[model samples]
Target: MQLIGRDAETGVLEEFLGRVRAGESHAFALVGESGAGKTALLQHIAERASGCLVVRVEGVQPEADLAFAGLYQLLTQLPVRFDQLPAAHREALRTAAGMRPGSLNWLAISLAVRHILFAASDKQPLICLVDDEQWLDHASVHVLAFTARRLGTRPVGLVFASREPSSEIAGLPFLKLNGLTDSAARALLDSTLAAPVDPAVRDRIIADAHGNPLAILDIPDEPLGGFALPLVTKDEWHLDTLPDETRRLMQVAAADFVGDPVLVWRAADKLGIAARAANPAIEAGLLELDTLVRFRHPAMRRAAYWSATLPQRQEIHQALGDVTDQRTDPDRRAWHHAHATPGPQEAIAAELERCTVRAQSRGGLSAAAAFLERAAILTPEPAQRARRLFAAAAAKHDAGARNQALELVAAALAGPLSAGERAKAEQLRDQLRTATSLMDEVRRAVEAGGNTDEVCIESVLEAWRGVEPTTADDYAKAVLYNGIGRHDAARDAALRALHTPLVITELAEAAARTGHFDLVKALPDPVGDWASGIQARIDALLTEGAQADAHHRDSITYLDRTHVRIELARAHLLYGEWLRREHRRIDARAQLRTALEIFTSMGAEAFSTRAQRELRATGETARKRTQPNHNTLTAQETQVAQLARDGLSNPEIGTRLFISPRTVQYHLRKVFAKLDITSRTQLDRVMLG
Candidate 1:
């Protein structure tokens, strides 16, 4: 573990040397990331020093950030232990070291040496080496700062190599080395490693390493542009002492590419590790700041990340995921899910896999998409990847992201899928039709009310035209195509269902959502008539006094809970506007609050925000709420609206979202009404402006 790569660190060393040569003790802080040749640079400087006594001291972050752990090695060298220290002496050391008075540790001894070192500095040039300065604990930092401040007047020359900055040494002379430059990295790689690696490989390794010499050194020379360096001893690091806090922080950081600050805070809070302790860990260059926190060095990061068992990692991920899920932001949700350590591959993975399959089976393609996302995180095999891709394609199809859906299908097909999987993927591949037939049929099926016939379940064959498929029923096909922005196709699919006896309720809801409002409004019973239970719920909401019964509505079956919730929310929002138009501000406030609250409670923050914006626009105050799915967009509505807002007329929208011109208008009304803004102009403003 002798030092390496100090050729570039010469300027800082010369500055320190010159200051010492002038008979003035100097303090120079060398700041750099861990595994960036900082330690090697220090050793090189020490080797080159003449008549300079080198004293190397290392500091580390602690579980409590208490003083003394940082200067442990120095303290153990003290002549007097517990036996020779007087009470006043002990008290002074604790205070200087930032340690709890009664806490028994090496801090008192270290503080005593700290005093001695400064006194010696008055006599001769003494180079004090303190590594990992950022992790030195508050007390150590204070003591170092004090020493540095006074050293300029003494004979001591202090040099610190730090990868990160801290509040300490605010004005002291410090040299900061930010990993190697590209040219330096290229040369260093070429020198240290061997030949088979091409220029690109060298560049990639250099880029990935971010110029940390130590990290670069770890890549197998075989991979390092075919360069090979002689082997040294095993991974023996001089920084042998693993402070509990540092160890814990490193372990967590290793688990992800980088840890989220919010997530790190929440995790520390959950684990009961204090902020004081965790902050130092980050400042110490131990954590790589990424979407998730990780070790800055690839070697250290991998070591830390894989330290835990699969089960342990799973628990950590699950904890973080749960915490992040509580956040109403989709970005946060995705972030948390990204790092959720997969728990046991047993039921957790099985459950996720099943959820993905079932969502497809039931025509709840969006759910399939979401569940597949979770599954991908938990499972990494090609089979799982293919399945997840398939499910996501189905979901994208439902959402009207047709191109995106096709891409997902292609990805699934590209996988090393089994015969069944390949056949299914190929089948889906064959269905990329431009027809509006199936899209329309699915719309009408949704218009036909009832459990089995819910619009959410419309798997109309007509919608499946351009959509290639295998083994999937028309219902799955219709719903998926509609979901994927094939509104005209979705409408046609719904229409075909009119001739067959099927659940019209789901169909109407889907059609209504798809912007095929005419079809939705023309449906029978609970779906078509607001006087029916479906419409009655809204009428009752209008009559029942908004906000009085928050979350209270005629409970719709969870079968189409996602759709029903969207509808009820819209009605309530409309009712609030109606109340406001009538000068019932108080009533409007309550209704709007209720609507937003309901959406929020459902984890539909996007929708909740929409409702809140309306409330704000109308000058009605709304209570804070969190929901996941309240924002309204039928698969059809989403399609038509997307094209409509793009300046496409009803006919064009019909072609895009896959419905007729009439269907385009049908979805436009819902979009405008749901948005609580009058005119396509407003919709246009929302989209473009």
Candidate 2:
């Protein structure tokens, strides 16, 4: 499907491509909350940028010793003089690249990442794609600035995509994204949601998501309505429902500046220090204690810290690594050994059903697996942990993390687990083994960089070409013709995409993109017709009590809407339409403005230019509607009116001020009418003269 929204981002990318194609240096910093589609957008842009060799290094939050993993991935491929690298980062990147996932030589690894790109040959302008610069090591941070400055005049655009604002990559061309607009969000709901939703309820769901596209589409059900959902800052969650003991443990863990065993112990000690015994909040699932006393989510710790008593709170983060120094337990001592930040959630069961439900709702199957890893680590019983581990592996397989999923499943089945857990793992392991093979093929296909569309077409044609002409293929042809400026061809293709006997999701998407406005649905129902058909269906579904499923289904409409907006931008550019906000949706304009501001702040000239172009074209326009003011009143007229307003009769005013009674009467009448006050007493509320 075509991408929607991201006008500002696409404009910046087009500008970068234009510069690179012309052999100029440019960079773009793509910023958005996680799941705002940064990686997907980057991939699309890279695919389209002419003559640009795109090398992507996805950022993963590694434990301390593995900090430079991203940089290592790049350095391993380039045949560069390790000895010739700048003294500042040469050894650091090399050493870190050689370390394991959970190790901690951050100083060296971080340094290596900074200089890894320096290994790039002056051979060509390379477009390096980096995801999550916010977690980059110090060396990587230093080298990023150096490379950006040193490579000027070379056809290179370092596309840095991040979730949070990073001071390191500040002053580069930035494109910050907010959630999709109501229309975009609705479009997403239309495609993914299985059940129907009422229009009013769907809108309310969007509002709850706070305009964050990922959040709107992911909210599973009302039962966990208030859980930590996306686009919500950590500061917003309410704490009244949580056990006080859970809150206490969380506050303590948050104190160490890091959450490890030593810090947990320190935080726990305080509960007793203040004369309150440490209670069992463990039963409520508020806190976990295996190697360390920790909360399920980082937000949990943050909230506790923020709400803690100031005097005690100040001592918690003991200056980065103070408390765990003297730990004896191998498990608890492990906590103080690393200095990385905590993650969103830490479920101690490998098969995290709650998280999976949330993930599926949000379309984040991969994340569900990652979260379940915590459950694996935190579970007390070996058998329970094994079961969770296997569940996590299976979930990972579903999420396309085939390798990780395969490894986890194998380990669970082969481990010294209980009969039940082991039996489940053995069965799941076989299933995963089969999936892993398909994943291997897909990865190979993705890596070949062959014509993606042709590959897709070949597969579809091989199966269904003879039976009936694929509507999607028909649509593709229309798109190709449209690209050559054939409006009629584009229209026909769009019609085919809409009219073809296809999946409900595909039809809704085609309609939304092609302007068959009636095909779009009002609710999150997947089966909405060409008009308000789906909204009606959603209502029917809701009358029967499938609220959660309805919400789950409705979110896809918004995701699809997001894709369409991106496609929309592509169309506008193709047709030579102005990249301005005037012709765009209000929500699009807002996201674009934010993205533009970020790019501009990043010192990305090309991207900033594009942002400005969009802002100029689409931002609200204020016409020069000036009101010419021309009013005249004599001082005598004012004095007369003032007296008349002071409760004096016209003759009395004339006698007091030595004026003619006729003039006084005239002024009083004018003042009364002009001031819109009939009674003399009302003159106080109005100013006359």
Candidate 3:
């Protein structure tokens, strides 16, 4: 079948395939909402895969929790020589596929999959198509994503169709499918119609379907009048009109989830449902029963499932569970039984608890968290429930979902937590909050007139540490140096950078510092509020009192809101210097004192001494320096130092702290400076005591 209105998408895919056939490996994800034809697109790609050996894996909803189930499906299709892989890789693959009695290792499994693909592709180019990837087992998704990223010139093309974008597959190319164009929608609707549709009715259907291919096919069958009917109402109409037996059959099929026709029929038999009951659904275009039970669209299946009463649905699940073979697929059986049982059941909860261990072994933290969460819900005891929730939260945190982890931890804390559990939960909460606050601080610094890059240099370094220096980083360094009044350094860096907003600010500041007022004035107006403040500082150099007063006050007000304390103090110092030059001694002293307090607290020696000199000029005696705090390291710096002291390498420390290795190194330098130590070996002696 020709995919309507996807000529552009098809062209891109054709070009991508041509490159793959020429021995370049590529991976692409098809992202869209349900009914957006992601599955149809995958099917179309398979049809066009003429010379390529196509390997298809469709994620079964019922098998989502079964560790490495999706991987097993895809691997079983490929003709790979296991002996060709290294012993460790072969063992890992064997263990993951349940052919060996051993624990699964995620990294090993990923490497094994990559080797298998490369081996399989030696003779023929391979195209692996994954549909409903969101429903795939988490362990398999991790393995596939890892393999896809490292395929470099392997002549393997991996394509995924998923309802939403996944962070796991981030950095890979994606083709997001939207609704069809208006003309395409009209054409598709015309082809589906038995007779001529009313012009107004046709237009309404087209408008309501929003160019969704599935919606266009389904909407033409709905009754329409001069008055418009909502698309949801039509769906409700279909569900409400189905025969009792047919709806029950749908509920059984939906509840079955694996799309196994034999399993569905067996479960239906257990419920005393006749085979002919599925005929009405088939006739209505809601279901297809042949080799397997298939829904017309995912939406139809969902509607069919939700149409049944809660007890009826549970009964269907129970029947499906009863019919499922425990020895072959215990995880799916346990999940079905858990759903069927309404209240807390110790046996079922224990089964789910055990699943978490297996999931974690396969490096499926997300899957582990889900199992723990479900186990918690099924636990009869409050204490066990709280413990399970806490474990789940920790798993979520390790999976790099801090916000969700925070929510789970908070929920766990609200229950009966032991003293140790309470402390651990609070610590996790603090970590999550600190991470969020750091992001907010950087955002505020950027919006205001602060050194945003200084707050994010570690993140920048982490993202680009091993990569060659781009003009972007040069511009960033120019901005950072300019903020510190290193005009020569700023100028040198600006010379190597492109003409971005940041580079412009750096050039203008460098010129102004060198007394080139004309160049500063000739520079284009700065972009954001923070850049405007930089421009204002240059303007202050040219103007006096009231003309620059408003700009100075604006800078102070804006910078004060951000957590970049050093930058805020600098803003105060600049404004105070201007006030003093204008002979406003009283106003100058106030700003100078504020700057002094912050600079002193942060151990910014130069800025603090500068603030003191300004205060002395205002006729106030410079206050004696407060005794320096024994420990002046910020929380993040301390964390980095402790990890370094514990013998963690920079990259390892960065991983634990969720920063970049470069950022970890930067913090280590600060730690060494504060502790009067030249090497990491001294951290143990100086920091421990």
Question: Which model scores highest in TM-score?
Answer: 3
The better-scoring model by TM-score among 2 and 3 is 3
Residue 30 lDDT, candidate 2, scale 0-100: 83
**Superior by lDDT: candidate 1 or candidate 3:** 3
Worst ten in a row by lDDT for model 2:
622-631
Flag regions of model 1 displaced more than 4 Å. 1-8, 62-64, 75-91, 94-115, 222-689
**Per-residue lDDT tens digits of candidate 1, residues 1-689?**
33334554676687777777567878877777677666777777778777766677776656228654655554544333544556655676665456644654444444455566655544456677777777677656665676576654556677766767566765666677777777777777666653334443454456557788766777653212111111333433322355665655555444322244566667656765565654555666655444444444555555554555567565555555566544343333333344454432433445555544433433234444545555554555777777777866766676555566677888888887789878766655545322122333334334534434433432333222223344334454444444344556655665665544342333444564455555653324444332244554333333435542332233222112333434445455555655666676766665565556444433333345655776776774444432122145544355566776667888676455322354346457767766767777667666542
- Model 3, span 157-250: residue lDDT tens: 9998898646887567999888899999998887776433345446645654668888778652322221111223224437668778888998
Give TM-scores for every candidate, taking all chains together and pairing residue i with residue i: 0.31, 0.33, 0.42
On TM-score, the stronger of 1 and 3 is 3
lDDT measured at residue 67 in model 3 versus the true structure, 0 to 100: 88
Name the lDDT value of residue 327 in candidate 1: 32
Q: Per lDDT, what order, best first?
A: 3, 1, 2
Model 3 residue pairs with clashes = none
Over all chains combined, what TM-score does candidate 2 have? 0.33
Model 2 / residue 667 / CA error / Å: 99
